[model samples]
Target: MTDRPDVLVVGAGPAGLTTALQACAHGASVRIVERRREPFRPSRAMIVHPRTLESLRPLGVVERLLRRGDPSPSARLHLGRRVVSTTLADVALRDTAFPHLTLLRQADVEQVLAEALEERGVPVERGVAAVGLAQDRAEATVTLRRDDGGAEPVSCGAVAGCDGQDSTVRRATGIDWRGRAYREEVVLADLDLDSDLDAGVLHVAAGRDGLVFLFALGEGAPWRLLATRPSRGGDAPFGQPGQPVPRPELRELLDVAGFDVAVGRVAWSARVRLQHRLAAAFRHGRVFLVGDAAHTHSPAAAQGMNTGILDAVNLGWKLPFAAHADEPDTMLDSYERERRPVARQVLALTHLVFFAEAAGHPAPAFLRGTVAPLLAPVVPSLTRPTLLAPVVRLLSQGWVRYRGSALSSERWAGGPGPRAGDRLPDETVTCDGMRTRLHRLTARPGVHVLLARDAEEVGASVVEDCPVSVHRLTSRPGRRMVAVRPDGHVGFRGTAVADLTAWLRLVGARARSADTATQPADTATQPADTATQAADTAET
Candidate 1:
C-alpha cells in the first residue's frame, strides 16, 4: 500500500527478512511479502555458526540472538558405547568475537529479525504471494495474489527472490534449479526426554543401523531429534513429505538406537527429503535469487540456513547502491560472481558430510564395541582445532574471500596483515577515549576507511574526498590505508594516497575535482560497462 518500494522481497523467512532489513539499513525502501498469514511456529534451522553471528552483528540482531539462544561450544559423537568429545573454544579464530555455536529455534530467529524490521517501520506484508515477475531496463513488475482472491501489480527498482526451494520468482525467470534429491528420508521431532543428556554438547549416536542426532533447543524448549530411517528394503515408512511420524514408530526407532529415554509431549514433527541443488543463475535482469531459491543441500553441517543468511547480507548491502547509481548493473553483477562460488563450496562440503555419515553404517560390530572405544581418545585429536584449522575455517566460513570479484583490488604488495578481498580482522583499538572493535566501527551502513601511522601524511586528501567514515589509529605501527566495503570485506589496501583515491574513483567514489592526479592507471581500458558485460556473459 505504501507506494511501490525500492525493493520487493518475496517470502518472510530468515533470508527474505534479512534482505529486507539490510536494504532498509542502506537507505532503500523495502516491502516484504509472505504467503503465510502467520509466522512459522515450528523450528527449522537451529545451529547459528560463529561467522553467521558476525554477519548478523551489523543488523543489530546478534545480541538479541545471543540473549535468547544457548551456547554450544562442543560436540559429543557416540559410536555405540564409545564417546568422543571435541571443544570448539581452542579452535575458534582469534579475530572473531563469537567462538561457539549458538542454538536457537528457527522460529525464535525469525521473530527477532521481524521485531528488528518492525522497529525500523518496515512491517512484512503477510498473506501476499508473488505469482509472476517481469522486468525491463528501468524497473521490475511483480504480480501478487492474495488469499482473499485479490490480485495486485507492484513495481519496484528490483526484486529479491528470498523465497524457498519452490521459488515462484526463480521459475518465472526461467532459471533452472538443477540437482538431485537424496533417496534417504530424514525424520525430525521436538519432544521432552526423561533421560540424562548434557545440554551444552550436541549429541550424536551412530550405530550399524543408522544415525540419530540430539540438539538441545534451549532451557525450556523441547529437544530436537533427527534420525535417518533405517533401510528396510525399499522406501521409508513415512508416506510423504511433512508427514508427522507416528508416536509408536518414533519410540521403536529410539529403542533400536539403544536410547533409554521416554518421549513425552511431542511439540512438532516432520519428515523431509534432502536435496543438493543450485540455481543456474542468481540474477535474471532486475530480479535476483537468494537463500534456498539460489542453492539448497543436505543439512549435514547446518550450512543451509547459515549460507542463506550470508547470502542475504552479501546482497542486501549492495542493493541500494546499485538501485540509485548511474551504472547500477556493475554492482548488481557482483552478487552472482561473489556468492555463486561460496554456494558451490558449501554444497560440496555438505555433500561430503552426508556421504561420510552414510558410510558409517557398515562398520563391523568389533569396531563399534571394542576398536571404536580404543580409538575414541585419539578421535578428538584428529579434529583438534590446531590440526584441522583449514577444515574448521571452511566450516566456520571465515575464509570466504572475494579475491576474484570485480569490486576487490589489491594493487599494493607486501602487506603484513589482511589484503583486499579478505575479511578485515576485528581488532580492538582505542578511539576518543573509548575502546571499540574494528567491526563495530566498520559495520555501519557505508564504506569505512582505516588509516594507520602517518595517516595524515599518506591519505589525507583521499580521505577528505572519499564519502566514508575515516578512523585514524596511531597506535598501530604501519603506514597502511585500508578501505572496507559495506559487507565487511576489504575493497582496497595500499600505502599511497594517490592509488587509494584512484581505486575509489574507479568504484564511483565522489571526487572533488575531475583532474585529480589519483585517477586509476587503467582507467582507459576499464569502461563503466565492463563489469556489467562480464556479468551478462557469466549468467548466459
Candidate 2:
C-alpha cells in the first residue's frame, strides 16, 4: 500500500472517478485525490448521452445511474409561443442499449462512481490537492497538500490530470492551455418551476433577448435553467462572472422571454464566462491530461462531462500497458492521437452552437409580433425527425471514433460492418444455451478478441503475461478476427490470425518463456467456448 499506485488521478469529478474506476477494473492500483473538502452537491453537468452510458456500463455504474436518472427521450426547441419544434424519437438508435439521454445530477454520478470505487477498494482521497508534479522515465511524483497545510509526495506509475480548467497537475507539467474567453457571460440556476412543462423533454428557447435552456433534473430535483445574455455596462445582476442572479431579475428575464413560470426556490445559481481552449498536448511523458484539463469550451450540447468520461475510458485501459517497461510506447502515444482530435471536434462544435445562440438577440418587436408567426409553419420542417438525427448523433457522441489512431489496424478485410477504430456495435447473439450481448462479453477488464471461428484454427494466441480474453463468434461473416480494446474500440480486424499475433507482440502482449509453465495451455483456444457460453449468459 505504501508503494506508489499504478495510477494517480487528480480531481475527483466524473472524469477522475471514471479514470479510477477503469484503472481499478484493469487490475491496476489507483489513488484519486480531490481538492474540494467534500463531494460536489450541485447539478453541474446533468446529461448522460447514450454513448457515454454504453461506455460506463463496463465500469459497472450505468445500471445504478439509469435507476436514479430520468430518461429524456427527445428534445424541443421553442421560439416563444409562435413556434415549437420537437426532435426525433429514439428510433435512430437501434444498435445501442440506451436509446435516450439520462438526466441525472452530476453529484449523483460522482456518488455512484465513488461507491463503485469503494467496492473495488479504491476510495477518493478528499481535501488533498496536488501542489506539484514531476515525472521521469519510470514514474511520476505528485506533491500533495492537505487542508491543514502539510505537504507530502506520492509517486505513481503515471498521473492522470482530470482537474478542472485551472489544473495544478497541468501547471506542474508546464503544458500550454491555449484558448480565448467569451465576452458574454452565462447564468445557470436550478429552480422549482410552477408551470406545466413536460419533464421528459429538454426545452430550449431563443429570442432577440438571448438564449434559455430548460432541463428537467429527474422527478424530485429542481429544473435546471441556463440562460446567456449580453453583458451589461456595469455591475449587472447576472452577467458578472460567478455572480448570483437575484430572484426578481431571474423572474423578469423569464417573463420577458414569454415563459410564464413561477420560480419557487433557487437551489443553485452561478454566472460563468465561456471559453474555447485545448491543451497543447494531452501527454507529458508519464503524466497525461484528461477531461477539462485537456479541453474547455462552451457547454453547448452538454459535451464537457460526457467527453471527459470518454477520455477517462480511453486512457484508463492503456495505462496498465504503458506502465510496464517492456511494453511498446505505441499504446501510450495512441492515447493522445485518438483523444486530441475528439477534443478538437467537440470544441469546434460547441463553439459554433454557443455563438449561434448568442447571435439570436431578442427579436425585434415587429419580427416577434408578425414575422415570426408567419414563419412558424416552416420551422417544423427544420426540426423534423429526419433533420434532427445528425444533431442528435453528434450530441450523443455515438459517432465519435479513433479511425486515425495508430492502434486501429485494418490489414484484414471484413464484411460490411464497423471497421477498425470504430466502436463495437451492441448486438444480441446466442452462444451455448444463453442469449447475450456482444458488448457484455467485451465490457470487462483487459483486451477482448472476437474470433470468427475456433481460436486454434484461426491462430489466435495469447501473449505470455498479457491480459487478453479471446471470445469466439460463430455467426460473424467471413473468417475474420476482431480484437477489441478494453475501452471497446476495435483495435485490430483481419482474416488472418498472424496479423492478430503480430499486433499482440507490438503491444507487448506476448508471453514470456519462463512463465509458460504457469500459463494455461489452451489460453487462446479455451476462450472460444467460454466466450460462446458467456455470449449466451451475458446480460443485455
Kindly report which residue stretches of model 1 are placed more than 4 angstroms away from their true locations once superposed: 72-74, 84-90, 199-201, 218-221, 230-241, 324-326, 359-374, 380-390, 430-435, 456-467, 505-540
User: Per-residue error at 248 for model 2, in Å?
Assistant: 2.9
lDDT (10s digit) by residue, model 2, range 1-540: 335898999999899999998877766788898988978556557778878877876666766786777664466666657646555444356566665566777788889999989887887889999988888888889999999999989999889999888888888889998987766677778789999878778777666666777877632346888787765334432112476778887887688677778889887676766667899999999899999999988777889899999999998877876544244488888889999988999998888777666644334434543465567678777765456566667897778788878788887554676788899988875433344567656555567777664443434345433467666565654577777877878888887767877776665553222232222212322223342233224335
Write down the RMSD of all candidates, one decimal each. Answer: 8.9, 5.3
Please give the lDDT score at residue 415 for candidate 2.
66
Collision count for each candidate, in order: 0, 9
Show model 2 residue runs off by greater than 4 Å. 73-76, 83-91, 194-201, 216-221, 232-241, 324-327, 360-387, 433-435, 454-466, 508-540
